[model samples]
Target chain A: MTAIAQQRKPGAEAATTRTRGASSGAAGGGRYATYLLPAAILFIVVIAVPLALNVYTSFTNWTGVGPRQWAGLANYRQLVHDSEFWASMWHSLALVAAMAVIPTVIGLLVAAALFDVIAKRFGPRLASVLRACIYLPQVLPIIVAAIVWGWILDPQYGALNVGLRDAGLGFLAHDLLGDPHTALLTVMAVLVWFQLGYPVVIFMAALQRTDPALTEAAEIDGATWGQRLRLVIVPQIRPEIYVVLLTCTVASLRAFGWIYALTSGGPGEATQVPSYYSYQSFFTNLDVGYGSAIATVMTVIIVAVSVVFLWAQRRHAL
Target chain B: MSAVLTRRRPARGKLARHGLAKHRGPAAWLVLAALAVLTAAVLFPFALIALNAFKPPAQYSAHGPLSFPDGFSTGGVSTFWQTADFGRALWNSVLISGCVCVLAVLLSILNAYALGIGRVKGRTWILGAFLVANFLPQEGLVYPLYDMAKAAGLYDTPLAVIIIFTVIQGAFGTYLLSSVLSTFPPELLEAARMDGAGRARILWRVVVPVSMPTIGVLLVFFFIWTWNEFFLPLVFLVSNSNQTVPVALGTLQGQHIMNPLTTSGAALLGVFPTIIFFLIFQRTLTRGVTVGAVK
Candidate 1:
């Protein structure tokens, strides 16, 4: 809420309150309702119809080309016992750690360092240049990123291996995306590298809004950097932290483009995330019904997570 | 010259903002060095791509991926460029993304104008629903959309992808933009009405012009997100001519994955435009993320 300085009212009333009170009436809704028509059409056709179709298809047996037969809860029943399904579900949590938890942790440290040291001590110009470098990966489509990374990590002639061989560390080189042991870890690292900039950017912005006086007082009181981060900076930007965690968590759960281009759950389904798994079931396995079920389940879980997160965000805002 | 370092209150007298003058020493240099190294690490792959894109495949194979290019070669770039049909892919991407951005922004403004400024009946529920809708993963919608597109005779068309993304991205844009616009100055709207302006005139003349910065931010996001999109494009765009850059490069990642030169060339192609975009919109890009986050 911007301070409505023009307000003649004795105390500050929110701009939002004034806007709402002044603009709204029965005629307002009736008149403006026409503006929503285009979006409503798009929403119904593009989001609503497809979503309803997906859920309904989950209960029926149909290949991509075929007539449907009711499968009832059979797909769900099978998924409950399916180890691969469970494994993919587990992989999502690992991705959340990589994409959300680790990035937020690293981003906080970096954002703080960038804000306190680079922005304040040196200059914001140098700090933002460094921030841009960290954020550079985000501009690439995941496929392009995965392609480059896949090349770098290729077992034989890839950059990492060739460089390693030259450095007399050839023995350490392995098929990073092919071998099961390293595949998921490699994927996670790529995600971390891709996602790190988001939180760094957000938290740094969040820090800008924080009361600099508190930080100044803490430093003058002889508090160490870590102590200042913990007690002063973190709490001040707690809301942004929650937002970052929530968005990144949602992004990780929908993680597909990286898995698709990097591994396709490959070298024997080693890096199979749920999205990729659902893709395989739909296109490769030709199990559209089963795929729909997997998709519906994933959607349900994500909606649940987002609803809870948004609720928490709303409460925290108050 | 730097306000951040220069801002001071003499009445307080004992301190500088961030206490920079007192703390200025080797510590600042150390932080700069650390940040430089981290930035280099993040950018290392891009540096490698630039280094290798100019080398011929055989030269790259022999050079162990570290040596400077042998007097500037374009063999790798031309090879991948021809093979990928990247020109067509680039055109397709531009077309689709441009359509999505404009259509989505228009839809967003209209939707947000109603929900935010008009304060329509049950606007809270509508906003909440839109928020949840924005979070729905593309996976659930893919197969049915695929099926429906076929039925509607729209599969493999750029229009199909454009239409779908317009709605999804527009919904999200609405959710974010509504929050930004809800607090729009009522005085401006009322004043416009006093001039005998109607709803459309007021929205276009009053709301949009005032909210240009936020709308600019949304346009940048829509373009990047649509351009970066892979799944729906890959699924919907089956024809070679219809495929976007990411889909073309992604689908063919297998054939060229082994040849380090061609892969680097492809990476360069896929990456250079983004680099340019980042350079151009660096400020807006950084600020855009926080807009949706904090509010």
Candidate 2:
């Protein structure tokens, strides 16, 4: 693959930089080759080869432990009929809403409130501290967040229920993670909590560059806070909004550690997303082919979503 | 600054003295109060972990979850570490993430040099490949890599994680550093070339030193990421001794499912390094969050 990629480079260079001959282009390519070699080799061995192999393996009937045979779309056919697969896809979409959309909206409000109102009224020091506090959860490992939240939601001695009961809200307290009906929503809530900081930080950073004069003019013109936020702040930070959306979209789709640590897709698969489902099918069930098919479909979906978002952004910009 | 605050102090104080309304209106106080509450809610879990980590079970159960611990005890913390073999796990994490940092950064510096400065042909394609590769979910790659690791006898070893993380991070590092280095002033490189410095020397002397700050930020991110990584380690390393910290804590959580004290202790132990890392490099971490979106 490296040789092929390298061989194709000079022809392109010769065409693009037309004044350069094939010999000099090859020499320039060789010079750059040494710089590119190590990353290319590692990328191929670890990522490219494995991904290619997965696409092939999806077509085969390979249990993880044994020899493989070409099954000819059997796995994909099984996925078409798999209720759990479709359910997980739905769950992922729900997570996208919970983790990406909801957080972006709330984060914008919080960050704008902090930067424009609180920072101005109180002090920058307080705002900085608050930003750090909000971002703290994001810095911790997902597994740690999962474990901490898992303990909090524990039925018997969990802090959440204990606090609820103490506060005389006993009727509201229940097994948030263990109940099938509430499990997925509960996980989504935790994810939203975990995700708020990313957008908050991103938006706040973007707001730092916002033209203060526009906001000042709006304020002086007796525009309401809501009006200023809608008409002034939001427009300045569109790119950051898109950034948060894309990052959180990928994050929620690939979210595993939290789900795995929190409930292990429990309460009878209520909280199971495709990532966890793929893990179960490939590793636990030893059905490598089925797992690979799920994984491939998931990859396609994620890439497709990304492309669509980028296209939308370009269109919006134009 | 003090003059402005002093001058505005009376008006702000008068607004506050009026109760709900303020210079900005009722929402000003409401938003501030709401933000304070949100900050508390966000920090509440960590506070729970810290407060409950050392509590004895009998005392903990008797006092209930919200009660302040009667006193400190290392018993739970010790138990968590011993059972989870956290010392081994911590060592494994350090070794693996350390290797990943070195390998990922080195490879990316070279690759970024090529793409960002070398202006190599097909640079855009190579860069696009790296960007797409970075976004490929781990689920899609883990199974095949699992098989490959088993084939190569690396499955359940630190080396497997090191190699995989290095590659994953190599893509990111390239994307980040290439953008960072691409912003390097062309005149400097031109001057170096005029002085007959070769590509390697120019990169090492001019580009590396000039880009060290960005590289440092990437290093911090890569280290925290690798240290906190849970999924790949869970899939790749099976044994207790070989498992990284997150994996070790995860195993401990499974075995001691009902023991919140141990879980809390292990959770604290698992996240301590990253907490320390963030506190130290807080600036860079925040910068990475937004600046990372830059092309």
Candidate 3:
């Protein structure tokens, strides 16, 4: 449905410049071009210039202090052998699994069930209410989500442990975020919870375009819900599935704020991701050059993934 | 169509003869149970925070972590406010998010107008840069921005956080508004120009009035994004008085890592405004999932 919505809108304004009379049109266009100035200036100062400076600083020994000395790929060389860099990279991969793969799979199942069975038999109103409930967490700040989970995983008095003990599963209770063995897994679970709502909402939007008659006919034909979802629903929502996957992957790549609040990349760096690691190197460790290197590498990875996703989408779309 | 089918079914007495309960009973139960559990999972943490925020510290520590408070009290919230200097933090956050909302929305109108309807040269490059900038993580720019802010004497100030949030959030706002504005009817602009309306007059009188709903949606999103923003504020604002709610809560977390009541209270303080905003604009937010995710 959204793909269709996107298709309906023309790509760019093609005739606005010439729609007016010829005499004053050039002067009018010049004045309109001035409208882009403020945004351009702000973007240049805040984003483009800083990013260029970041690349430049990665090659120097700038330590958040005075002048810089050019060290020429030394930071990149150090990053090659850096154990923490490699470890954080591994953590990011794990995060991609937790935040992207698992959420997409589960969100699809929940959304399908909601649309096919729940809404079909009951009512759309009920399904929407349920959708809103599941989507509640997405609107919250990531930092707040991490803090709430931090409280839940608090070793001494977390609700998670409290709930486990209350349910007579005390053996399942442990220092979820304090023990290195389970720290990363615990963080992953919380991040998964944070990401669950997004894909569900996206899929639900896509499902609006599905013909209920087809689902009803498939049902009368003795097709199980799973078969119907596989044979009918998934194909119809492939574009949205790609949308969720790409956006979630990009989100996981940019992960930092919440992880820092949750673990501070702690329990001996068990939950350290590239973004957090970069932050540590910059702010805490005061190693700006190495930090910039970590950041530049992260940016490259993100941009690469985005490019691949867009390329793939273009091919499939065409 | 489904409504018509359902209405005709009861008139035909098909429901009574067939007894729909045979098919709907177990399936409905299962779906309801699953949805109930999901709702609980999503709301449990907020329930915990709301419950714990009201408990006095002594009673909070005496009881189980998941236990309900013995009685409601404002002690924890007041104590958290004093402990974390949340008044100033709240003021700082309000100022930052408010300015960001206004600036981002205003700049987006300009940027979107130029790119969306003006047919300006290089519009493609400008839109592409803004869209790509939206995906670039703050981590990539944090170090350089920190240095730049410090050098410019804007470090540890609300103005620094405000400007950074404005720039970052404004980019997304521009992207969203441009998509919405690009669909504006060209005939309307022609009609306005035929009546001798200038560019400025047409923008405020025609474009803005027609796009108010979309602009309203962007306003809500930008405010929430700025208000919930953590990383940039953490990097830019270092002083106690300068911190936003989230950053202040962060600092308080490090200080009172062991105090659940205080931390939970502080967390509620940090999240209260966002919850209010979401409740007020819940329809817009839920509907926006597609726009936000797909874009």
Candidate closest to the true structure, highest DockQ: 1
Q: Estimate each model's TM-score.
A: 0.95, 0.91, 0.90
* DockQ values per model: 0.65, 0.42, 0.49
Q: What C-alpha lDDT do the candidate models reach, one value each?
A: 0.86, 0.84, 0.81
Error of 3 at B226 (Å): 0.6
- Largest TM-score belongs to which candidate? 1
Model 1 error, position B158 (Å): 0.4
Residues B1-295 of candidate 2 have per-residue lDDT tens digits of 6566556655655554454223566767788899999999999998988888888778887877688888878777898888887889889989998999988998899999888766688887888789778889898899889889999999898998999999899898998888777557666776887899998899899999988888888888889889888888999989888988889877767666537677778877866888898889999999987778644
* Candidate 3 lDDT tens digits, B1-295: 7667545544444433344424577877797788779879888888888888888677777776677788888876788899778899888888888899999999999999887777576776787778778878888898888888888999888888888778888888888888787668878887898999988899999999999877887888888778788888888888898888888887677665437777777778867877888789988876666776555
TM-score of 1: 0.95
- Could you tell me the fnat of model 3? 0.64
| Candidate scoring better on lDDT of 1 and 2 | 1
lDDT of 1 by residue, B166-200 (tens): 98889889999898887787778778988999889
The CA lDDT at A124 in model 2 is 78
lDDT of each residue in A1-318, candidate 2, tens digit only: 654898997686546444333433566766876788878788889998999998999999988766789999899999999888888899999999989999999999999988987887777788999999999999888888889999899888899999898899999999999999999999989998899998999999899988665666566568998999999999888877887898899989988887888888888879888999999988789888998999999899888877777667667666
Model 1 interface root-mean-square deviation: 1.9
| True-vs-predicted CA distance for residue A294, candidate 3, Å | 0.4
